[model samples]
Target: MAFKEFNCPSCGALLKLEYRFTETVICPFCQQSSHWTGENFEAKGEKVILADYGSKFSVGLQASFWGTKLGERKEYKFKVLGRVRFEYNDGFWDEWLLRVEGYEQNEYWLQEDEGEFFLFKKFDNLPSVNEYSELEVGMYVDWEDYKMFISEKAKAQISGGEGELPFRVIPGEQCDFVDGILLKEAIPVSIEYLPDNKKAFYVTIFNLDINDFVFTEKKQENVY
Candidate 1:
């Protein structure tokens, strides 16, 4: 995909497309939401400009790390393309969209909350459930022959976002979520329940070491 630039419809502030799959963009200049239609930005509602809380990650930042998958470790590089903040009872967490180099699936999510980090990749085969009301903490789910136990069930509201995101972020939208842990492998599982009964599943890495990542100021070449 080629890199593209366009002006924000709300304020005419210049913005560039950081990833190929962007569906929503938050203008840094005007702090408003815009929908991307492959060619142009359509102005939408206003979005909050998240205050700097001294986070180590930011949109457009690049890093390389030794990431582990299925007990195999390999070096990988990725860029921070966007972020969405979710507010729950405990406070909030930032979910970052990353474009990882050399991965079969280029996009992944890195979640940070209260100084703890987790890396997650989109997972198919959502658990059998009609709604969030059916799930409770400690409920057992038999998924792919693995016995998983629900660890958390909560509702979180979308607070704000930055840069380019794969999905549209509607501020103040409520999201119901169920989190489980695969007992045998000790892997985490997450399911986000959206409006219209749409759901998203993710395979998570719990407590990923912060030291494994190395951030850089320079942009990676050939990202396009």
Candidate 2:
């Protein structure tokens, strides 16, 4: 049988109409439960709770990082572009899709949970210097292999601890960027400073339970 396509009237989320005989389908994008009868479909506007699906990060959320190391500590910044849920032997894993504005043209995914952050294993290509040069403040930079870039302003804040940093300097607090994206609050559990205060900054990922986390949806104005 031929398949059909439908758009959500409430959120405009794409819905795939899979069968001529099938009369009902759930939207994979938005959690809104919908029913299809004949040529026209009705949006119930009821929230459907999935067994495994939960909160998800939107595309416009700004990616921010904190450094515990001293002396030109790298601070990699990026924006979330997509998110996917994966089920494995252990449990469910939420993979955040990121796009590095100036470093890489393609998208990368990162596992969002406690413990160690998992790298995107889908891509074979790496970021380049040319891409870095194109980066602007508030642009999304995935935390892949590229280390965080500590701005001179941030360095001054760390040295003196007197002035406020451009981004959130505190352990937790949602920070705003020029692009209108909001970043989640995170604290560095550990930091390793480099010698001469100008080389490297190693930081341990924040340990937090996934159940306690909340996801922010993408604003309608930001959708393209």
Deviation (Å) of 8 in candidate 2: 4.8
TM values, all candidates: 0.87, 0.32
lDDT of 2 by residue, 1-224 (tens): 12567776557876554223333344456644455545665655354333433334443566544323354444446665434333333444454555544544543445555544533323222232213234455444334443343221111111110110111111111111111111232322111121222222223332324333333443335223
Question: Candidate 1's error at 63, in angstroms?
Answer: 0.7
For candidate 2, give the lDDT. Answer: 0.36
Report how far residue 185 has shifted in candidate 1, in Å.
1.0
Per-residue accuracy of model 1 over 38-139 as CA lDDT, tens digit each: 667787766699876667788878787787777888888888888988889988888898888876265588987555677888764365543578788988
Question: Candidate 1 — worst ten consecutive residues by lDDT sum?
Answer: 215-224
